[model samples]
Target: MSFIAIDRVSIQPNRRPLNDQKVAELMQSIKANGLLNPITLDQNFNLVAGLHRLTACKLLGLEQIEYRIIAYQDVDHARLAEIDENLIRNELEALERAELWLERDQILERIGLRAQSGENQYTKKGGESISPPPKTTVQLAQEAGYNKRTYQLGKQIAKNIDPEVKEVIKKTPIAKSHSTLLKIARAGSKEREQAEQAEQKAQEAKHQQKQEEMETQAKLAAEARTKLKEKQLIALQSSTAQKQAKQSIRSARTQVEKKINTTPILPGAELGDEWILGRHLIYCGDTAEDKFIGLLPSNAALAIATLSFEWNHDYLIDEAHIVAVLAREGHIQDFCARHRMPFRFEWVLGELYVGIYSQDPILKPEKPVGIEGVEGIVAYLISLYTKHDNFILTPSLGHAEVLIACERMGRICFAGDKATENVDRAIARWQKWTGQEAKKEKHCYT
Candidate 1:
């Protein structure tokens, strides 16, 4: 033991309970009878134990304190010594004691301080070293002045308690009681369960709301369809041939003749609803009649005509079917007059269907046949309309080829077929071009 400057003795990092009321009591005792035990320090003069004594000396305004310097193999050994000294000499809070015990246990294990079992070490030669068993929880608990069960419980509380609650426990003795901490832990679990239930109920409510909205929209749509069907029937019965349409066609023809006579070398094709003259106007029409028209075969033309109106109107053509075919040949006036069907136009990306009318037999153009001619027709008609401002509808299986052709030319084509094979092939072709899979569509016929 030797005297060391009071300022030279630094507190250990793991020291607990600084400036407790016990320090004043110690100071009083030292003033009366003087310090009986010297403070312990490591070679570096760091305080290892007797923190209260050191504090008392400082309070008494002592320039130096009596201390013993101990040599330690490592920091862990030093810490273990400090913890053991406090555990033996002073009463500590349950949490403080638990923390110290855990710290000491870890240090002892880390530094390989093991105890020999039974007489195993005695049987060894005098100079031989024997391995010892590790310290058990019971031993560590006992050293900390707690029974094994209380120590284990305290260990868990120290490990898992919230930081804010731990601070409260350290400051408030009542909060440090084991019962209080157990109650808080249980309450935390219940709170978490309530929060989860609330979130699940919110999700379920949102799903129910979405389902109701869809049902209401579906009902409104069904009512609208019914009203439109009733109106279409009334319109078809009162429809008659338009004398004005024949006059318009004749007037258009006269204009074409006049242009031909004036300019022997016409600069461009004359565009009509059915015919494209020079390289001029692209004529695309939709005559949803059964008559064979245009360059296609009668069967193919009729299929395409029926498909045009059917697909464009979303198979709402059942109403149109009930209305008689009000077109005929020779009476171009009456044929044109009958073109009073209210047509709704919307721009979409798809095929273009052209309409034609005739009295006797419709004249078939001597042009390319099948899909090739259809492609040519689409290309020509495309020149007549702005790309984004036009779309076509075809319901024939053969129209799939037309749709594909239009798509190839960078045109938006909407086409459907009663045949599943045609629909599948059309979807496949579109997917190939767009690199996007087409969703299955509901069809009127299928």
Candidate 2:
């Protein structure tokens, strides 16, 4: 190699490190050793190699240094020689290598040397006077091992990025992943619209899931409430049945006691001497003096009592006897007065007395004169017995007896006089009084 004067050469301003400390050290070494290796240059005296050493000599203010001026016709071979030299030294940073590779491509293009296939150069063939430079900045970057995809994406990033953000990117080197992500962030309205659509779809899916969960929970709660209500109804029905059975047992016991206490008036006779005429008779003692009469029905008796009345062989005598008995009972007389009945013995013991004055006057008695339908009339009267204070009707008896009594009374007064209307009105009033229509219909009728 022949050495020439450094002042005769011009270094190409490319691929130089800007590190202050590294430049300072190289300047100190050049000042001491005086550039042991010469820089390489083209026939026009333009630098083709030794860029770092030339920079160090200039920084050190050296008056003279060594270099070699080669011809432009040999520049391609010279560039390849420079590249091989740098590779052996491993002296370039990634950015520096990128810049050097880019410069080599430009030189190849200027000389009309197209890179062979897979050679990564740009050039034009013969007969071309002048043409626009081949290889854009993006294509040059790709050949330098800068990712082509990234370079293509970077163009988009450069296009859409805010001026302020572009300034920041130019000043600061960001990691590749972050750079790509930022490019996406900087994309236009179309990209943003796509992102918004994705977000909305996700939100709708979440809302539908929540709504379905709520509906499922509501259905489960409703089912649980229905099961609880059914359990309560069953318990109530069981309690009612138990009460009815107890009342039945009590009524049977009362009837048995009455049968045992009754004394026969004739030999081998079943009829008693002092028989009380009423719906139910309960005997209180085992002896004559100890015996006290219980008039009217007990709750237990009323629950199961059926109405029945008959005229005996001594019907007139029985009528007379019951009349005498009512007269002797001061409370019975008072009951008649309270209910607004005339107190004369004729009025008490006449046709009216005979009418309701059999052995069991209030039972299924025969029709009296002027009472055309005696069964219906007596059914009406016995129904009134259930309404009286001393009746002692149980819950079941009260329910059935009151409903029947109301129906009978309403039928009698309003027969053929708007029967349906009267019945509906009476039923409505009765339901209001008892509060049992709905439950009764559901349980007993349905």
Top candidate when judged by TM-score against the true structure: 1
Name the runs in model 2 displaced over 4 angstroms: 1-3, 13-17, 31-36, 74-446
RMSD (CA, Å), each prediction: 33.9, 43.4
RMSD of 1: 33.9
Cα-lDDT of candidate 1: 0.47
Against the unseen true structure, what C-alpha lDDT does each candidate score?
0.47, 0.38
TM-scores vs. true structure, each candidate: 0.38, 0.28
Model 2: how far residue 99 lies from native, Å: 5.1
